[model samples]
Target: MRLIPNMISSLPSSLLRRAAFVVLIFGGLAACQKNDASAGQVTGTLNDAAQAAGQKLDQAASYVGQQVDATKATAQQNLDSASAPSINIDPAALASSAQANLQNAASTANAQLGKAASITGQGLEAAGRKLQAWSAQNATSSASSSASSSGSSSASADSSDAQKQMDK
Candidate 1:
């Protein structure tokens, strides 16, 4: 009779305790899931500093460009003021020097040609003497051969007559 009411009251209290525990556990898990923004904040600040440094670098490049233009203009002015030296050559002297060199070369060539001609003449005389000696040698050998052939035929005729008289 009293057990039913007491059991129903205890049920509500138990449900309430479980809901509170679930809420605490979900809150802990949610806290773990959330991202830490401190590192991102630091990196964002560094990116901004880098962009600022790039702007300064661009300004410095502009200053360098202006200085380069100034240097170029000054160099052009110096080139305009400076002059190259001019020289005038004497035509007669140039021609006489060239003529003297040509005369020396021609004399050297003429002397060499005369020496070569003298050597060629000596070579021709020696070759002529050698050819005449060879011709004389050949003529003497041919005359001796003809005389020996005539003597050999006469001896053969005398031997044949002596043999016929013996046979008779």
Candidate 2:
């Protein structure tokens, strides 16, 4: 008791207040240090979780990128194929070919008619028959122009048949 009294008498009020403040700060620090271990563990767990989440995000991004690339490649291939020449014949070309074949058939049949007039009845009958056949073929081909893709082939057949008759 006497020692306490002597110390209080020796210390100024300002010094006492400063000393109390320092003690309180140290006491709070000591209490916080006691819980530091658990806090450190929680911080480490949070860091690991964040790392795992980052890896998952990276994987998802990579997968999406691969899918996008595949889709682009497929689209490009479709575009290339669409731009390629088709196997189907042009409608205008088929009509032109059919018209030309009909003209040729008519000219040839007229020539045959002129020759048949010089020849016998049998020659005239054959030439008349060839002309009728050519007319029928042309009619059928013209009617079916918008209906089928084989119009060009049919026209070629008609021209060949007319040539065969001419040869005969």
Candidate 3:
């Protein structure tokens, strides 16, 4: 401390004023440099936050794309299932079965018609025989009744003639 005072006392007033001015300028420059460093740190933090936001957006976009792809695939699968082809139809066999059924039905109907015709023929023959027998019976009964009536009428005539003779 004694040396510092002795050096100050020996320095000229003009030189001391120049040295103080130099120290003040250096201190101001250091403060400005510190402020610049803080600004650089703030800028770096903002850049980091922006990068994080960009990354999140990218992730969201990727997730949406995946969902779209999944939905599209499911729709395609549903369409495929709906439009699936049937492989069990056999046209030739179906036609043959139908023809066979028709033939059987036609044969059954023909047989039934023939039976009906035979029964009808038998019924007509029986009716004709019955009618002939009934007609013959009626004819015989009418002939006998007419003969009896004629005989009675002749007897009545003879009685009337005898009565007339007696009266006379």
| Model 1 stretches with alpha carbons more than 4 Å out | 1-88, 151-168
Best by TM-score: 1
C-alpha TM-scores of all predictions: 0.37, 0.29, 0.36
Candidate 2 C-alpha lDDT tens digits along 17-121: 533453354334333321212345535533443344344334433443443444345444544554678845554554454444434433443343333323332
As a whole number from 0 to 100, the lDDT of residue 116 in candidate 2 is 30
TM-score of candidate 3 versus the correct structure, residues matched by position: 0.36
- Candidate 1 lDDT, tens digit per residue, 18-114? 3345335433433332222344543553344334433433443344344344434543443444333464545455444434433443344344334
Local distance difference test scores for all models: 0.42, 0.42, 0.42
Worst 10 residues of 2 by lDDT: 29-38
Residue 161, candidate 1: Cα error in Å is: 34
- The 10-residue segment with the lowest total lDDT in model 1: 29-38
The worst-scoring run of ten residues by lDDT in candidate 3 lies at: 29-38
Model 3 lDDT tens row, 76-163:
4544554658545344553444344434433443443344334433443443355345544554455456557778665556455533
